[model samples]
Target: MASRQMQAAQIVEFNKPYQLSQVPVPQCGDHDLLVQVYAAGFCHSDLQVLRGQFGAALPLIPSHEPAGKIAQVGTQVKGSWKVGDRIGVLNFKNACGQCVGCRQRLRRTKRTDPRFCRKRQTAGFKHDGAFGQFMLADPNTTVHLPEKVSFEQGAPLMCAGATVWGALQKLKPDVKPGEAVAIIGIGGLGQLGIQFAKAMGYRTVAIDNRHEGRRLAVDVSEILKPDLVIDSSAPDASDQILDFTAGEGLAGAVVCTDSIEANAWSLQQLGNGGVMVPVGLPQDRWQFDSEAMVFRELTIRGVYVASMGEVEEMLKVVAHHDISSHITTVDFDQIPSIVERYADKSMKGRLVVQITQ
Candidate 1:
């Protein structure tokens, strides 16, 4: 029998529009699942790839956040995973089982953690991603989306959702119930962070410069009940944050923007011995006060994505808290316009492509 062909959108050249073409359906390898993508999210990383910011290889399929139903299951995949199962794909598409990240995590944590693996490749960059009819997914990185969550909501959870969840997880044990944490950048990731921080019982403060961002932060404060929403563009921004926290300063802060200045200020807003978790990557290197970091004993940490276990845990939290992504849906062919909106800073919320039913 001839192989099946599926439609996909690919970046044929850097700084150019994606070419929509038909490609063969990816075969399901052992420990892999073939998913008929229902929805795929548009991310800043995808924009970076289009603009040649990361120098990623050419002809790559962008959009790492995808959710769909299983069309085929590898023979090695056991029990619950079967054709027709609703699932979401993780960025860590696959990791070598022999790598330290996989083996050590399996032994110690009783789970497969791909974050530490050197050979692990993300779905959108290293392999074919889900801006298509079908995508091959590693079983280890796939998570079951809850029944109530729509494909659009579940898709962003794979990337933006997981990223913030992993960053917030670093606050455990240190951030007490009444302590405050500030989220800088009220975009897609920051919005989710606000929801999660509030649900986790932390006094949440949101910071952003755009009037829309400040408005969204205040909306979060009203809906999710965050403690304060500051306009970071204000000259007295840092003072406002300190004042809100009663001069003790934030117990910790998550830098969700790619601005180097925002990152530096995020570190400065932290109280003594506070943790600064940076989730976004900047084109330029971040320069902070070395002496202040040493004197305050502050810790700077970068969280990329959650481990496999962490993804599952985050899904549970989303389900329990009824968390959802604020998104606008577009057809698969509308990516170029969305990219333009992204470049012009006009996109109000996350953009998700409806790939298939």
Candidate 2:
């Protein structure tokens, strides 16, 4: 048989562009699926990996947010999944089923644990990812897409959507619906956070910088319809939040920016007994007011991506609420230039690579 070949954008060196070239198609393993890529979402983390920020392996095919149809499945794959099933790949490629985390999750809930995996790694960074015509997928890290969600919409949900979804989920067992919640940063993750907050019945505040140009918060407010939009570029951003909340500060805040400056402001905006969740990966060191935290009894926590069960639930919410990532889809071949542009001046919305139709 002739060797199967596919087009892939690969990073051969650190801080270099992805080389779009023909490579041998990866074969499906015992628990793997050969996914025919439809779309792949690019993110800031991709930039981090490309610049060796996370010490990512070189010659990587970068893009974890991929949605597509299954072209082939391995024999050991056991489930309702089948060839031609529309699905999205999870960022956590595979977790060891024998770990303590995995056992605990399996016993207590349907969630899958990405940590404590014997061989845990992100798909796009460690393994060949979705910037290609085809990629091998671990059936364990893949989820079925709902009929209402398009491949493009499902792509970024694999990571960005799941990250924020999991963060918002942290807001309660204690926090009640209709409590004022703020989403900081107003970028891709924050945009989705706005929609999720509203759908979850929180009085959502969309926070970001005042624009010299088109304002993301304003543009998104028209779509997701956040209850309030505050430009934090101005010094009165926290004041605006307090005024809106009637002298009490935010019940919860999700800080989506990587800037320590943004994180500090978000922490200050939290009300008494409020929780502040930081999702951004900042490069610099950060400090918080120990006195304020002690006096106010504020909680600062962090959230990674969602568990598999949470991803399913988030997809349902998204589909039902008609929520979507504001994505700019480009041809797969343009991955190199776009990635460079992203590092210098990031795009407003999620940038996606369309591999197939």
Candidate 3:
């Protein structure tokens, strides 16, 4: 049973360090689980939220990429889950199951009462997050973790893995299973994007601006076995990409960096009839030529958080393909310091914050 209060990393204000404090461990009375967090992924999204980029809740305990065992479940909760059940928490806390969008999609097989529909609350942002030793998860936003998946790998799957995989699943850019798909900015999301794209039977061309990242891409390629690696740091990267694409250009590209400049280039590199899905967030507005978009039918679009169904499909792909996460684990207390460093693009792969694992 959860005690009244517990350890949590809550931010007091903008630009201030996250403060570690003992706060009440909330109950799962609202058909939610009191998850004893085992491993929570430290995501770039966490950094974005911490810096107020997401602009949802403040003075908050911030962490969305969470996986853990069920510590407790509400009495009225209706599911096969019990205490000790392992599950993953997604970035979206709740979407109204009664709204036309929700009812048509997630609510089809789920609890359909609009009153139970959570139009409000986002864990780790509007609501509290899994940065704590214990966090709350509603039935709608939780994903069951497969037995074969480890806490470290499962941890990153909650966000980095799911975010990219979910994007690919939703966008479904028309590159055939064996055709090439270019990825920009080989970082946490980019790395996962490469893996998912490769696993989906798409040849991957990982593009990065730094020698360090290019070298890392080589290492990742050996592990993940992506088809092509291009050093975008070189001036001839676009030309090299053209050569690699047989002078045609990529079938599609998923812009995975938090930069408008990089995305603008991806827009250009994507020749006739190509789609570029922008999964990364940038502070500046994206600019592109309307003529280019119309003439070539170039697609530049954005993707947000994953749906519950999409999260399950992502997990299935992870299991069927056995895509592992190269993760670094840290104790719960290290989250603030680690998150700060992560904001500067210092941490690697996905950071799994140890809650119990």
Candidate 4:
């Protein structure tokens, strides 16, 4: 029989439009699962990869956020996973168990999780990703999609949701319930961050400079909406935050935007000894006020995507809270145009491409 083929949007060259081509369906490895993708989410990192910022190899299938049903299972894949199982695949693939990151006792430690294994081939980055009809997914990092969540919502949750959720998890040790927490930048990640913080029992504040972001923050349902929304561009934005917190300042803040100014301003909103977690990846180095750091003894923690266990936990919380992802769903053929439009950074929420019903 002829080799099975599937249509995929591939980056034929750097700084060029993706070519939608018919490619052979990838076979599952001993430890992999073949997923028939239903929805794929577009992220800022995809733009960076396309611009050659990460030096990704050419002819790549771009998109790290993928959710779908299992089509096939590997021979060695021993688990409940089987055909037609709803799932969300994390970007990180096979991790080397011998690496320091993998051997570490604490998975939450900075850059020490198995997901950080240097030898790992990340989906959408080092390996073929989810912009295709079918993709190979690592069973270890994959999570079961809750019945309440749709494919479109689950797709972005693989990256954007996991990212912000992990960032908030870092603050739990120091920050407590009823204490104020600010989600800076109210874009794709920030929108979820606010809801997650609220669900986690924190007094969530939504901060944004853009009209679309600010609007999104206020538009969420009453239960999941931010307790306070502030315009970061306003001169008294800091004062407004302090007033909401009764002048104590935020207990913690999650910086969700790539803008340097937003990152810097997020730190200023934190009270003495407050923690600041930056989830956004900015190309430029971030500069901070060393004097404030020394006197306030504030903590700045860097976080990446959540571990498999955390992603599963996040899904439970998402389902229990009835959290929803604001998304714009488009057909798979529109991937090129969607990518081009995403360059303007005007998208309000997550953008997902529906590959199948």
Candidate 5:
């Protein structure tokens, strides 16, 4: 039997550090699974949540990216899911299947995608999330972790990897194989984006203004590394990208950074009718030249995390390509320091909190 109480790192107040406390284990609903969290990822969104940007309820646990084993299975959940099964959970929970977003998703994909459901309570925002020993997860948005993927890697894939994968999927119809694709940021998400793009057979180019980011891109394994790493701050960076693409510019650009300047600058590097997907959530409003957009026929598509089916596909791709997340694992109690590191943007890659064996 699971313990009634578990250790958790919680935000007792807004714009304050997390407080470690013993909280009741979240009850598993009829349509939910009780997960014994093994690893939880720290995301940029977590920082926003700490700052109260997401209007998260106080005294809430704070990590949305969690990978774990099923401690108990709900009777209402009819599937292969059983206790002891390894899984990774998406942030959205208890999606109302009758809503317009859900119906539209069903109509188009013939799959009940909960990602677009407005009635869903986002983990770490409206509801208690990971950073605890256990959490309740909806089966609709949960995915089985691959044998080759560890909990540390799976944690970040729940958000960072899935977000980029979904963004690249948006460009599939328009961008052809061997076409140029630029991934801006070169951070955790950007690193995974580069691998996904490469695995998809796109000529991937990594762009970053920071020296550390540029170095990280270059340091990736030969098979997964981008075809070219460009300094986005360079005066001739756009020209360099254009030249690489035979003066046609990039076929697709995925903006993984939250910098508004990087977002606007990415538009200039796209070819005619090229698509740009913004995966970052910046507080500031994004501005663009209307004439340039109209003349170039540039496209901007905003994407959230991947649908459940897409997330499964992403895991398969990760397994097949041996894709991995560069992570720094910390003990659960070090959650406060992790927040500080993230706030200052001092971390190299994803940060994961080891919760259990």
Candidate 6:
């Protein structure tokens, strides 16, 4: 039998901060895996959840990206996974299996069940999440961790890495090799976006409005050997782009910034017929003029979270690609403490917390 209580972070109410509490451990269903969460990544989304942006499923355990060993499994589960397997938990836990979204996504992906499958329980968002010593995950969405990657390295991919990877795949039909691709916001997601875009053989451009963000963008560019890294924050920014692309504009722009202004400018900066993909979430409205859409014929796309199809592909990339997210690791007890800090936007990088450590 499982322990009656475990360490968890509770979001007692919206607008107020989270409080660390010892809560009853959740039980697994027939198809669930009682996972011993060794590592879990804290995301900006988690910060949003804390700020009551997503609103409380009250007392949320806010870690989505997690890597851990399987402690127990319920009946009806059968696959490559077995007891003690090390795997990465994905962000979207379950899509409503009966919905059109799930039907379409299920038809498109390898997993039998959709990760957005709302009918079942989720690790972080819906039910109890990964901010505890043990988390219940659907084995269908779990990606086996490679020996080369630590629990921390695998953590971010459970969400950020997969999100960017899936967006790129959707943009694949339009993105040609050797084309110029720009990414806004050099934060955690943007960092992985740069690497993924570079790996796809696109000439990458990393853009940021801040000093450290620019430096981080440049650092990724240098390592990934992107064609250029532009500071949109710098003076003469558009002029710099005009020279770089020679009035042709960028071949494509992945607007990881999610800000209306940043995304709008990036969309306007795209070349004729260029693809503008938005991966970040914004609190305000998305303002885009019809001219940019109709006149330039730019393709604007927004991706929330990746479907199950992207999980395996992303894991294979993580296993082979020299991809690693810059992260700050924390212990499970600090979930509420750190979540409050993130809500204010003062913290930095991918956050990976170990529940069992």
The most accurate candidate by TM-score is 5
Overall lDDT per candidate, in order of appearance: 0.84, 0.84, 0.75, 0.89, 0.90, 0.75
Best candidate (score: lDDT): 5
lDDT-best of 3 and 5: 5
lDDT of 3 by residue, 132-187 (tens): 88887777678899998877788787777767776676547466787778878777
TM-score-better candidate, 2 vs 3: 2
TM-score of each: 0.95, 0.94, 0.90, 0.96, 0.97, 0.91
Please provide, for model 5 over 42-116, each residue's C-alpha lDDT reduced to its tens digit, 9 standing for 90 to 100.
Answer: 988988888898886688898999999999998899889999999999998786889998899889988766678
Least accurate 10 contiguous residues by lDDT in model 3: 109-118
Report the number of clashing residue pairs per model. Answer: 0, 0, 1, 0, 0, 10
Candidate 3 has an lDDT of 0.75
Model 6 reaches what TM-score against the true structure? 0.91
| Tens digits of lDDT, candidate 4, 1-357 | 788999999988987888899999998888889999999999988888888887787789999999999999999997899999999999997878667666672454533344767678888976789999999998878899999999999999999999999999999789999999999988788888988999999999998888888898876778988988889989999999989989988899999988898898889888998999998877799988888788888999988778898999999999999887789898888888977667566667889999887
TM-score of 3: 0.90
Candidate 5: regions farther than 4 A off? 1-3
3 or 5: which has the higher TM-score?
Answer: 5
For 92-192, candidate 2 gives per-residue lDDT tens digits of: 76777777877777777665576446567678877788998898887877899998999998999999999999999998775679999998888778888
* Candidate 1, 1-357: lDDT as tens digits: 989998899988888888898888888898789899999998988887777776678778888999999999998987689889899999775667688677886898776666767788778876678899998988878899889889999999899999999999987767776799998998888888888888888889989888877666655435575688888878998898778888988898888888998899888998888888998888789888898799888888878787667889988888888877678898987876768766566566688999995
- The weakest ten consecutive residues by lDDT in model 4 span 105-114
Say which prediction, candidate 3 or candidate 6, comes out ahead on TM-score: 6
lDDT of 6 by residue, 254-328 (tens): 777768889888887887888888887788888887898898888988676665556777777766777788778
Instruction: Kindly report which residue pairs in candidate 2 clash with one another.
Output: none
Task: Provide the RMSD of all predictions against the true structure, rounded to 1 decimal.
Answer: 1.8, 2.0, 3.0, 2.1, 1.6, 2.4
Q: Return whichever of 1 and 5 wins on lDDT.
A: 5
Where does candidate 4 clash, by residue pair?
A: none
